[model samples]
Target: MFNERIHRLLKEISEAFADRRDPFNNEWLSKNDVSIDELHQLTGAVSSILDGFLAAPKETQVLLLSVGMAASSFRG
Candidate 1:
């Protein structure tokens, strides 16, 4: 279940990049330092949250993942 979520998230992130209106102009991936792996985790956590897993103690875990994602997205 966890691995499935992770894979789904990665796909979404990759799709987000591919669907960008101006892929070349945005440079989101390069400027944000968003790695494929990090994107996978972020999307996974976000998916879990949307699926109602972001409750009580899980909220903290979700927040941490979000922070990690943000940091990694700008790791440079």
Candidate 2:
């Protein structure tokens, strides 16, 4: 049973990185000093935040966009 569990876990991990050309691949992580787990967590957080933004009322979205634009302009 333990060996079967290990095999399944390995398979899942292998499938997770099946796309080598993706920026989230091992090479990119190594170059950026990031771990795969950390990348996964950040990706999840960003996805959740974006989902909230998308589901928000249109006026709220517009206000957020305006604020974001203002912030970007101040960076220059």
Candidate 3:
């Protein structure tokens, strides 16, 4: 069970680029004198993610919006 949990955590961290360090932490990026061009493979990542979401089917898009609304409701 512990190994399984560690595997899942590692997978999540990898997906979020936790191994890269600078992308998620502003202070680290600034401290290291990182410019926009040197963002370690994150230059077009947002555009790609947004494009993929936009390219998803309309039904899938509606489901995504609904999920967002449900999450927002919980934040209130």
In terms of TM-score, which candidate is strongest?
Answer: 2
- 1-76, model 2: which lDDT tens digit per residue? 2245334433333344443345456765576566566566556654676898899999999998897667556644
Candidate 3, residues 28-52, lDDT tens digits: the string is: 4565455565453344544565697
Rank all candidate structures by their lDDT, best first, as comma-separated numbers: 2, 1, 3
lDDT score for residue 33 of model 2: 62
lDDT of each: 0.57, 0.59, 0.54
Q: What would the TM-score be for candidate 2 when compared with the true structure?
A: 0.57
In candidate 2 the C-alpha lDDT for residue 6 amounts to 39
lDDT score for residue 12 of model 3: 39
Give the TM-scores of the predictions, in the order they appear.
0.34, 0.57, 0.40
Candidate 1's residue-wise lDDT over 1-76, tens digit each? Answer: 4566455545455456545543223374566566677666675665675565355477777786787578557643
- Model 3: residues >4 Å from true position, as ranges? 1-43
